[model samples]
Target: MTKSEKTQIIESLTIEFKESNAIAVCDYKGLSVKDLESFRVAVRPLGIKVQVVKNTLASIALKNAGADGLEFRDTNIFIWGEDQISLAKAISKFAENSAGKFVIKMGFFEGNVVDTKHIELVSKMPSRDELLGMLLSVWTGPARYFVTALDNLRKQKEEN
Candidate 1:
Protein backbone atom coordinates (compact mmCIF):
# COMPACT_ATOMS: atom_id res chain seq x y z
CA MET A 1 0.00 0.00 0.00
CA THR A 2 1.10 3.57 -0.66
CA LYS A 3 2.04 5.93 2.18
CA SER A 4 -1.00 8.13 1.66
CA GLU A 5 -3.42 5.22 1.89
CA LYS A 6 -1.70 3.96 5.00
CA THR A 7 -1.86 7.43 6.52
CA GLN A 8 -5.55 7.68 5.81
CA ILE A 9 -6.17 4.29 7.36
CA ILE A 10 -4.26 5.19 10.47
CA GLU A 11 -6.12 8.49 10.78
CA SER A 12 -9.48 6.82 10.45
CA LEU A 13 -8.60 4.11 12.96
CA THR A 14 -7.31 6.69 15.39
CA ILE A 15 -10.65 8.43 15.23
CA GLU A 16 -12.41 5.13 15.78
CA PHE A 17 -10.27 4.40 18.82
CA LYS A 18 -11.04 7.80 20.27
CA GLU A 19 -14.76 7.32 19.77
CA SER A 20 -15.02 3.76 21.08
CA ASN A 21 -15.31 2.83 24.73
CA ALA A 22 -13.69 -0.57 24.27
CA ILE A 23 -11.51 -2.39 21.80
CA ALA A 24 -10.82 -6.11 21.47
CA VAL A 25 -8.43 -7.94 19.21
CA CYS A 26 -8.72 -11.51 17.97
CA ASP A 27 -6.88 -13.84 15.67
CA TYR A 28 -9.09 -14.72 12.74
CA LYS A 29 -6.47 -16.89 11.18
CA GLY A 30 -8.51 -19.79 9.91
CA LEU A 31 -11.91 -18.13 9.57
CA SER A 32 -13.40 -18.01 6.10
CA VAL A 33 -14.57 -14.83 4.43
CA LYS A 34 -18.23 -15.83 4.60
CA ASP A 35 -18.01 -16.63 8.28
CA LEU A 36 -16.30 -13.32 9.03
CA GLU A 37 -18.85 -11.43 7.01
CA SER A 38 -21.68 -13.16 8.81
CA PHE A 39 -20.08 -12.34 12.12
CA ARG A 40 -19.83 -8.70 11.11
CA VAL A 41 -23.50 -8.64 10.18
CA ALA A 42 -24.52 -10.16 13.50
CA VAL A 43 -22.53 -7.58 15.41
CA ARG A 44 -23.44 -4.57 13.29
CA PRO A 45 -26.94 -4.40 14.74
CA LEU A 46 -25.39 -4.24 18.18
CA GLY A 47 -23.27 -1.26 17.03
CA ILE A 48 -20.07 -3.23 16.98
CA LYS A 49 -17.66 -3.06 14.09
CA VAL A 50 -15.45 -5.89 12.89
CA GLN A 51 -12.49 -5.00 10.77
CA VAL A 52 -9.55 -6.95 9.39
CA VAL A 53 -6.65 -4.55 9.54
CA LYS A 54 -2.91 -4.59 9.25
CA ASN A 55 -1.16 -4.85 12.61
CA THR A 56 1.28 -2.01 12.16
CA LEU A 57 -1.37 0.48 11.14
CA ALA A 58 -3.63 -0.59 13.96
CA SER A 59 -0.82 -0.20 16.43
CA ILE A 60 -0.10 3.31 15.24
CA ALA A 61 -3.76 4.25 15.41
CA LEU A 62 -4.14 2.78 18.87
CA LYS A 63 -1.08 4.56 20.13
CA ASN A 64 -2.27 7.82 18.66
CA ALA A 65 -5.51 7.44 20.57
CA GLY A 66 -3.52 7.02 23.81
CA ALA A 67 -4.29 3.28 24.07
CA ASP A 68 -1.15 1.17 24.00
CA GLY A 69 -0.08 -2.39 24.97
CA LEU A 70 -2.04 -4.31 22.32
CA GLU A 71 0.02 -6.83 20.41
CA PHE A 72 -0.94 -6.77 16.76
CA ARG A 73 -0.03 -10.13 15.29
CA ASP A 74 -1.15 -12.55 12.61
CA THR A 75 -4.60 -12.16 11.07
CA ASN A 76 -5.85 -9.81 13.75
CA ILE A 77 -9.46 -8.75 13.51
CA PHE A 78 -10.09 -5.65 15.59
CA ILE A 79 -13.44 -5.30 17.27
CA TRP A 80 -14.90 -2.27 19.03
CA GLY A 81 -18.15 -0.61 20.03
CA GLU A 82 -19.50 2.35 21.96
CA ASP A 83 -19.81 0.26 25.09
CA GLN A 84 -17.50 -2.31 26.58
CA ILE A 85 -19.98 -5.04 27.44
CA SER A 86 -21.40 -5.46 23.94
CA LEU A 87 -18.05 -5.71 22.28
CA ALA A 88 -16.74 -8.02 24.96
CA LYS A 89 -19.80 -10.22 24.74
CA ALA A 90 -19.69 -10.44 20.95
CA ILE A 91 -15.99 -11.29 20.86
CA SER A 92 -16.13 -13.74 23.75
CA LYS A 93 -19.14 -15.46 22.28
CA PHE A 94 -17.60 -15.66 18.83
CA ALA A 95 -14.29 -16.96 20.17
CA GLU A 96 -15.98 -19.55 22.35
CA ASN A 97 -18.18 -20.71 19.51
CA SER A 98 -15.28 -20.82 17.09
CA ALA A 99 -13.75 -23.69 19.10
CA GLY A 100 -10.38 -21.99 19.31
CA LYS A 101 -10.08 -20.83 15.75
CA PHE A 102 -10.77 -17.22 16.66
CA VAL A 103 -8.35 -16.77 19.49
CA ILE A 104 -8.78 -13.58 21.51
CA LYS A 105 -5.65 -11.57 22.01
CA MET A 106 -6.63 -8.98 24.61
CA GLY A 107 -8.67 -5.83 25.03
CA PHE A 108 -8.78 -2.19 26.06
CA PHE A 109 -11.71 -1.73 28.35
CA GLU A 110 -12.43 1.78 29.62
CA GLY A 111 -8.86 2.75 28.81
CA ASN A 112 -7.29 -0.22 30.54
CA VAL A 113 -5.80 -3.43 29.26
CA VAL A 114 -7.91 -6.50 29.84
CA ASP A 115 -6.78 -10.10 29.74
CA THR A 116 -8.72 -13.26 28.87
CA LYS A 117 -10.21 -13.68 32.33
CA HIS A 118 -11.42 -10.09 32.43
CA ILE A 119 -12.87 -10.48 28.98
CA GLU A 120 -14.82 -13.53 30.13
CA LEU A 121 -16.12 -11.61 33.12
CA VAL A 122 -17.16 -8.75 30.89
CA SER A 123 -19.05 -11.11 28.60
CA LYS A 124 -21.19 -12.25 31.48
CA MET A 125 -22.06 -8.69 32.43
CA PRO A 126 -25.50 -7.43 31.48
CA SER A 127 -25.72 -4.76 28.82
CA ARG A 128 -26.28 -1.10 29.72
CA ASP A 129 -29.98 -1.30 28.87
CA GLU A 130 -30.48 -4.36 31.02
CA LEU A 131 -28.67 -2.71 33.89
CA LEU A 132 -30.84 0.36 33.54
CA GLY A 133 -33.98 -1.79 33.63
CA MET A 134 -32.75 -3.57 36.71
CA LEU A 135 -32.07 -0.25 38.37
CA LEU A 136 -35.55 0.98 37.53
CA SER A 137 -37.05 -2.14 39.03
CA VAL A 138 -35.04 -1.66 42.16
CA TRP A 139 -36.06 1.95 42.39
CA THR A 140 -39.75 1.14 42.12
CA GLY A 141 -39.75 -2.00 44.25
CA PRO A 142 -40.33 -0.32 47.61
CA ALA A 143 -43.08 1.95 46.28
CA ARG A 144 -44.89 -1.02 44.74
CA TYR A 145 -44.65 -2.95 47.97
CA PHE A 146 -46.01 0.00 49.95
CA VAL A 147 -48.98 0.40 47.58
CA THR A 148 -49.80 -3.32 47.77
CA ALA A 149 -49.61 -3.29 51.56
CA LEU A 150 -51.98 -0.31 51.69
CA ASP A 151 -54.46 -2.01 49.37
CA ASN A 152 -54.46 -5.19 51.48
CA LEU A 153 -55.00 -3.18 54.66
CA ARG A 154 -57.95 -1.35 53.09
CA LYS A 155 -59.53 -4.71 52.11
CA GLN A 156 -59.11 -6.07 55.65
CA LYS A 157 -60.76 -2.95 57.13
CA GLU A 158 -63.69 -3.25 54.71
CA GLU A 159 -64.17 -6.93 55.70
CA ASN A 160 -64.19 -6.03 59.39
Candidate 2:
Protein backbone atom coordinates (compact mmCIF):
# COMPACT_ATOMS: atom_id res chain seq x y z
CA MET A 1 0.00 0.00 0.00
CA THR A 2 1.00 3.53 -0.71
CA LYS A 3 1.85 6.04 2.05
CA SER A 4 -1.38 7.96 1.58
CA GLU A 5 -3.41 4.77 1.67
CA LYS A 6 -1.70 3.68 4.85
CA THR A 7 -2.32 7.07 6.39
CA GLN A 8 -5.99 6.92 5.47
CA ILE A 9 -6.29 3.49 6.97
CA ILE A 10 -4.57 4.61 10.10
CA GLU A 11 -6.89 7.60 10.32
CA SER A 12 -9.90 5.35 9.99
CA LEU A 13 -8.51 3.03 12.66
CA THR A 14 -7.89 5.96 14.95
CA ILE A 15 -11.47 7.02 14.55
CA GLU A 16 -12.68 3.53 15.32
CA PHE A 17 -10.52 3.30 18.40
CA LYS A 18 -11.82 6.65 19.59
CA GLU A 19 -15.42 5.65 19.12
CA SER A 20 -15.19 2.09 20.37
CA ASN A 21 -16.59 1.11 23.76
CA ALA A 22 -13.98 -1.64 24.04
CA ILE A 23 -11.08 -2.94 21.98
CA ALA A 24 -9.54 -6.42 22.23
CA VAL A 25 -6.27 -7.52 20.77
CA CYS A 26 -5.96 -11.15 19.79
CA ASP A 27 -3.64 -13.48 17.91
CA TYR A 28 -5.26 -15.17 14.93
CA LYS A 29 -2.13 -16.89 13.65
CA GLY A 30 -3.33 -20.46 13.45
CA LEU A 31 -6.96 -19.96 12.52
CA SER A 32 -8.07 -21.51 9.25
CA VAL A 33 -9.75 -19.32 6.71
CA LYS A 34 -13.07 -21.05 7.25
CA ASP A 35 -12.82 -20.67 10.99
CA LEU A 36 -11.94 -17.01 10.67
CA GLU A 37 -14.91 -16.49 8.40
CA SER A 38 -17.15 -18.21 10.89
CA PHE A 39 -15.77 -16.00 13.63
CA ARG A 40 -16.47 -12.91 11.56
CA VAL A 41 -20.01 -14.02 10.81
CA ALA A 42 -20.70 -14.67 14.48
CA VAL A 43 -19.36 -11.29 15.59
CA ARG A 44 -20.82 -9.23 12.74
CA PRO A 45 -24.35 -10.17 13.71
CA LEU A 46 -23.67 -8.60 17.09
CA GLY A 47 -22.43 -5.32 15.50
CA ILE A 48 -18.74 -5.92 16.10
CA LYS A 49 -16.14 -5.14 13.45
CA VAL A 50 -13.24 -7.55 13.50
CA GLN A 51 -10.18 -6.43 11.55
CA VAL A 52 -6.79 -8.00 11.07
CA VAL A 53 -4.40 -5.10 10.86
CA LYS A 54 -0.64 -4.76 11.05
CA ASN A 55 0.43 -4.46 14.65
CA THR A 56 2.57 -1.42 13.87
CA LEU A 57 -0.35 0.26 12.17
CA ALA A 58 -2.58 -0.50 15.13
CA SER A 59 -0.01 0.86 17.55
CA ILE A 60 0.37 3.99 15.47
CA ALA A 61 -3.39 4.43 15.29
CA LEU A 62 -3.72 3.98 19.01
CA LYS A 63 -1.00 6.55 19.58
CA ASN A 64 -2.66 8.96 17.20
CA ALA A 65 -5.91 8.49 19.06
CA GLY A 66 -4.05 9.19 22.36
CA ALA A 67 -4.68 5.61 23.47
CA ASP A 68 -1.10 4.41 23.50
CA GLY A 69 -1.85 2.68 26.75
CA LEU A 70 -3.49 -0.21 24.88
CA GLU A 71 0.04 -1.72 24.50
CA PHE A 72 -0.69 -4.07 21.63
CA ARG A 73 2.17 -6.18 20.34
CA ASP A 74 3.07 -8.99 17.96
CA THR A 75 0.72 -9.76 15.07
CA ASN A 76 -2.64 -8.66 16.44
CA ILE A 77 -6.15 -8.68 15.11
CA PHE A 78 -8.31 -6.00 16.61
CA ILE A 79 -11.91 -6.69 17.58
CA TRP A 80 -13.81 -3.57 18.41
CA GLY A 81 -16.93 -1.47 17.80
CA GLU A 82 -20.39 -1.31 19.46
CA ASP A 83 -21.55 -3.48 22.37
CA GLN A 84 -18.04 -4.40 23.44
CA ILE A 85 -19.03 -6.98 26.02
CA SER A 86 -21.04 -8.90 23.45
CA LEU A 87 -18.09 -8.90 21.09
CA ALA A 88 -15.78 -10.07 23.88
CA LYS A 89 -18.21 -12.81 24.81
CA ALA A 90 -18.47 -13.98 21.23
CA ILE A 91 -14.70 -14.07 20.82
CA SER A 92 -14.18 -15.78 24.13
CA LYS A 93 -16.76 -18.39 23.25
CA PHE A 94 -15.14 -19.02 19.89
CA ALA A 95 -11.72 -19.28 21.51
CA GLU A 96 -13.06 -21.79 23.98
CA ASN A 97 -13.63 -24.17 21.10
CA SER A 98 -10.76 -23.07 18.89
CA ALA A 99 -8.27 -23.25 21.76
CA GLY A 100 -4.79 -22.84 20.31
CA LYS A 101 -6.09 -21.45 17.04
CA PHE A 102 -6.91 -18.14 18.68
CA VAL A 103 -5.81 -16.30 21.82
CA ILE A 104 -6.63 -13.10 23.60
CA LYS A 105 -3.71 -10.67 24.02
CA MET A 106 -5.02 -7.56 25.70
CA GLY A 107 -7.92 -5.14 25.71
CA PHE A 108 -8.81 -1.53 26.22
CA PHE A 109 -12.02 -0.40 27.91
CA GLU A 110 -13.16 2.84 29.46
CA GLY A 111 -9.71 4.35 28.93
CA ASN A 112 -8.00 1.54 30.80
CA VAL A 113 -5.70 -1.15 29.47
CA VAL A 114 -6.95 -4.56 30.49
CA ASP A 115 -4.89 -7.70 30.46
CA THR A 116 -6.08 -11.05 29.16
CA LYS A 117 -7.57 -12.08 32.50
CA HIS A 118 -9.46 -8.80 32.76
CA ILE A 119 -10.67 -9.23 29.20
CA GLU A 120 -11.97 -12.66 30.12
CA LEU A 121 -13.69 -11.16 33.13
CA VAL A 122 -15.24 -8.49 30.92
CA SER A 123 -16.45 -11.18 28.55
CA LYS A 124 -18.14 -12.96 31.43
CA MET A 125 -19.96 -9.82 32.47
CA PRO A 126 -23.60 -9.38 31.49
CA SER A 127 -24.42 -6.92 28.77
CA ARG A 128 -25.88 -3.57 29.67
CA ASP A 129 -29.42 -4.63 28.72
CA GLU A 130 -29.12 -7.86 30.66
CA LEU A 131 -27.85 -6.04 33.71
CA LEU A 132 -30.72 -3.59 33.45
CA GLY A 133 -33.25 -6.41 33.21
CA MET A 134 -31.71 -8.14 36.21
CA LEU A 135 -31.81 -4.91 38.21
CA LEU A 136 -35.46 -4.40 37.27
CA SER A 137 -36.33 -7.92 38.39
CA VAL A 138 -34.60 -7.35 41.70
CA TRP A 139 -36.32 -4.03 42.20
CA THR A 140 -39.77 -5.56 41.61
CA GLY A 141 -39.24 -8.60 43.84
CA PRO A 142 -40.54 -6.89 46.96
CA ALA A 143 -43.57 -5.53 45.15
CA ARG A 144 -44.36 -8.95 43.71
CA TYR A 145 -44.10 -10.58 47.13
CA PHE A 146 -46.34 -7.90 48.68
CA VAL A 147 -49.02 -8.43 46.02
CA THR A 148 -48.95 -12.18 46.54
CA ALA A 149 -49.21 -11.74 50.29
CA LEU A 150 -52.23 -9.44 49.87
CA ASP A 151 -53.95 -11.96 47.59
CA ASN A 152 -53.41 -14.72 50.16
CA LEU A 153 -54.87 -12.51 52.92
CA ARG A 154 -57.98 -11.74 50.78
CA LYS A 155 -58.40 -15.47 50.07
CA GLN A 156 -58.34 -16.22 53.81
CA LYS A 157 -60.89 -13.46 54.51
CA GLU A 158 -63.25 -14.83 51.85
CA GLU A 159 -62.99 -18.36 53.29
CA ASN A 160 -63.85 -17.17 56.84
Candidate 3:
Protein backbone atom coordinates (compact mmCIF):
# COMPACT_ATOMS: atom_id res chain seq x y z
CA MET A 1 0.00 0.00 0.00
CA THR A 2 0.98 3.62 -0.53
CA LYS A 3 2.43 5.75 2.24
CA SER A 4 -0.71 7.88 2.46
CA GLU A 5 -2.92 4.82 2.72
CA LYS A 6 -0.74 3.35 5.40
CA THR A 7 -0.85 6.62 7.31
CA GLN A 8 -4.61 6.71 7.02
CA ILE A 9 -4.86 3.13 8.21
CA ILE A 10 -2.70 3.91 11.20
CA GLU A 11 -4.81 6.92 12.05
CA SER A 12 -8.02 4.96 11.73
CA LEU A 13 -6.60 2.09 13.76
CA THR A 14 -5.49 4.49 16.44
CA ILE A 15 -9.03 5.75 16.71
CA GLU A 16 -10.35 2.21 16.99
CA PHE A 17 -7.76 1.31 19.57
CA LYS A 18 -8.66 4.32 21.65
CA GLU A 19 -12.36 3.53 21.51
CA SER A 20 -12.06 -0.20 22.09
CA ASN A 21 -12.63 -1.70 25.52
CA ALA A 22 -10.17 -4.49 24.78
CA ILE A 23 -8.03 -5.94 22.01
CA ALA A 24 -7.36 -9.60 21.30
CA VAL A 25 -4.46 -10.87 19.20
CA CYS A 26 -4.91 -14.18 17.44
CA ASP A 27 -3.25 -16.38 14.85
CA TYR A 28 -5.34 -17.06 11.77
CA LYS A 29 -2.70 -18.98 9.84
CA GLY A 30 -4.61 -22.11 8.89
CA LEU A 31 -8.09 -20.66 8.77
CA SER A 32 -9.88 -20.93 5.46
CA VAL A 33 -11.68 -18.01 3.85
CA LYS A 34 -15.06 -19.41 4.87
CA ASP A 35 -13.97 -19.94 8.46
CA LEU A 36 -12.50 -16.46 8.67
CA GLU A 37 -15.69 -14.99 7.34
CA SER A 38 -17.65 -17.05 9.80
CA PHE A 39 -15.54 -15.69 12.63
CA ARG A 40 -16.20 -12.17 11.40
CA VAL A 41 -19.93 -12.85 11.16
CA ALA A 42 -20.03 -14.29 14.66
CA VAL A 43 -18.26 -11.35 16.31
CA ARG A 44 -19.76 -8.59 14.19
CA PRO A 45 -23.22 -9.07 15.62
CA LEU A 46 -21.73 -8.60 19.07
CA GLY A 47 -20.17 -5.25 18.05
CA ILE A 48 -16.65 -6.61 17.79
CA LYS A 49 -14.39 -6.01 14.81
CA VAL A 50 -11.85 -8.54 13.55
CA GLN A 51 -8.94 -7.07 11.65
CA VAL A 52 -6.05 -8.80 9.91
CA VAL A 53 -3.06 -6.50 10.00
CA LYS A 54 0.56 -6.73 9.05
CA ASN A 55 2.77 -7.03 12.09
CA THR A 56 4.95 -4.13 10.95
CA LEU A 57 1.97 -1.86 10.32
CA ALA A 58 0.47 -2.89 13.61
CA SER A 59 3.70 -2.10 15.41
CA ILE A 60 3.85 1.27 13.78
CA ALA A 61 0.27 1.95 14.66
CA LEU A 62 0.74 0.84 18.22
CA LYS A 63 3.89 2.89 18.63
CA ASN A 64 2.29 5.93 17.08
CA ALA A 65 -0.74 5.54 19.26
CA GLY A 66 1.44 5.10 22.37
CA ALA A 67 0.15 1.57 22.85
CA ASP A 68 3.66 0.12 22.98
CA GLY A 69 3.01 -2.97 25.09
CA LEU A 70 0.38 -4.26 22.66
CA GLU A 71 2.92 -5.40 20.05
CA PHE A 72 3.04 -8.94 18.68
CA ARG A 73 5.81 -10.50 16.62
CA ASP A 74 3.88 -13.16 14.76
CA THR A 75 1.13 -12.81 12.18
CA ASN A 76 -1.64 -11.09 14.16
CA ILE A 77 -5.32 -10.71 13.77
CA PHE A 78 -6.58 -7.88 16.01
CA ILE A 79 -10.03 -8.09 17.54
CA TRP A 80 -11.17 -4.86 19.14
CA GLY A 81 -14.37 -2.96 19.85
CA GLU A 82 -17.33 -3.17 22.26
CA ASP A 83 -18.54 -5.97 24.55
CA GLN A 84 -15.12 -7.22 25.56
CA ILE A 85 -16.37 -10.19 27.55
CA SER A 86 -18.58 -11.40 24.76
CA LEU A 87 -15.69 -10.96 22.34
CA ALA A 88 -13.48 -13.01 24.61
CA LYS A 89 -16.23 -15.63 24.90
CA ALA A 90 -16.56 -15.73 21.14
CA ILE A 91 -12.83 -16.21 20.67
CA SER A 92 -12.62 -18.81 23.40
CA LYS A 93 -15.66 -20.63 22.08
CA PHE A 94 -14.32 -20.54 18.53
CA ALA A 95 -10.98 -21.86 19.71
CA GLU A 96 -12.68 -24.57 21.71
CA ASN A 97 -15.07 -25.59 18.94
CA SER A 98 -12.75 -25.19 15.93
CA ALA A 99 -10.48 -28.13 16.66
CA GLY A 100 -7.62 -25.72 17.39
CA LYS A 101 -7.70 -24.09 14.02
CA PHE A 102 -7.91 -20.60 15.54
CA VAL A 103 -5.50 -19.79 18.33
CA ILE A 104 -5.54 -16.78 20.63
CA LYS A 105 -2.14 -15.17 21.15
CA MET A 106 -2.87 -12.54 23.78
CA GLY A 107 -4.99 -9.54 24.59
CA PHE A 108 -5.08 -5.97 25.91
CA PHE A 109 -7.80 -5.12 28.37
CA GLU A 110 -8.27 -1.81 30.10
CA GLY A 111 -4.65 -0.89 29.30
CA ASN A 112 -3.38 -4.13 30.84
CA VAL A 113 -1.72 -6.91 28.87
CA VAL A 114 -3.47 -10.25 29.12
CA ASP A 115 -2.18 -13.73 28.38
CA THR A 116 -4.12 -16.86 27.47
CA LYS A 117 -5.05 -17.62 31.06
CA HIS A 118 -6.33 -14.08 31.48
CA ILE A 119 -8.27 -14.44 28.27
CA GLU A 120 -9.91 -17.56 29.62
CA LEU A 121 -10.77 -15.70 32.80
CA VAL A 122 -12.18 -12.87 30.76
CA SER A 123 -14.26 -15.32 28.75
CA LYS A 124 -15.82 -16.55 31.95
CA MET A 125 -16.71 -13.01 33.06
CA PRO A 126 -20.31 -11.93 32.88
CA SER A 127 -21.15 -9.34 30.28
CA ARG A 128 -22.10 -5.82 31.41
CA ASP A 129 -25.78 -6.43 30.74
CA GLU A 130 -25.67 -9.82 32.43
CA LEU A 131 -24.05 -8.32 35.49
CA LEU A 132 -26.67 -5.59 35.57
CA GLY A 133 -29.45 -8.16 35.29
CA MET A 134 -27.91 -10.20 38.09
CA LEU A 135 -27.71 -7.11 40.26
CA LEU A 136 -31.35 -6.35 39.57
CA SER A 137 -32.36 -9.89 40.43
CA VAL A 138 -30.41 -9.78 43.66
CA TRP A 139 -32.06 -6.51 44.59
CA THR A 140 -35.59 -7.72 43.77
CA GLY A 141 -35.32 -11.12 45.44
CA PRO A 142 -35.28 -9.74 49.01
CA ALA A 143 -38.15 -7.35 48.30
CA ARG A 144 -40.22 -10.17 46.79
CA TYR A 145 -39.58 -12.41 49.80
CA PHE A 146 -40.56 -9.62 52.17
CA VAL A 147 -43.80 -9.03 50.28
CA THR A 148 -44.62 -12.76 50.31
CA ALA A 149 -44.07 -12.98 54.06
CA LEU A 150 -46.22 -9.88 54.63
CA ASP A 151 -49.03 -11.31 52.50
CA ASN A 152 -48.92 -14.60 54.42
CA LEU A 153 -48.99 -12.77 57.76
CA ARG A 154 -51.98 -10.66 56.65
CA LYS A 155 -53.89 -13.78 55.57
CA GLN A 156 -53.24 -15.44 58.97
CA LYS A 157 -54.44 -12.31 60.80
CA GLU A 158 -57.68 -12.23 58.73
CA GLU A 159 -58.37 -15.96 59.37
CA ASN A 160 -57.77 -15.60 63.10
| Residue 76 in model 3: lDDT | 76
Order of quality (TM-score): 1, 3, 2
Supply the TM-score for candidate 3: 0.89
The sequence of per-residue lDDT tens digits that candidate 2 reaches over residues 83-153 is 76897798789888997879988887778788888878878999988999999999999999999999999
Candidate 1 has a TM-score of 0.91
TM-score of candidate 2 versus the correct structure, residues matched by position: 0.89
Off by over 4 Å in 2: 70-74
The positional error of residue 46 in candidate 3, measured at the CA in angstroms, is 2.1
Clashing pairs in 2: none
Q: Can you tell me which runs of candidate 1 are displaced by over 4 Å?
A: none
- Clashing pairs for predicted structure model 3, backbone only: none
Give model 2's clash tally.
0
lDDT of each: 0.91, 0.85, 0.85
lDDT of 3: 0.85
Best-fitting candidate, measured by TM-score?
1
Off by over 4 Å in 3: 154-160
For candidate 1, the per-residue lDDT at 42 reads 96
TM-score on alpha carbons, each prediction: 0.91, 0.89, 0.89
Distance from true location, Cα of 82 in model 3, Å = 3.3
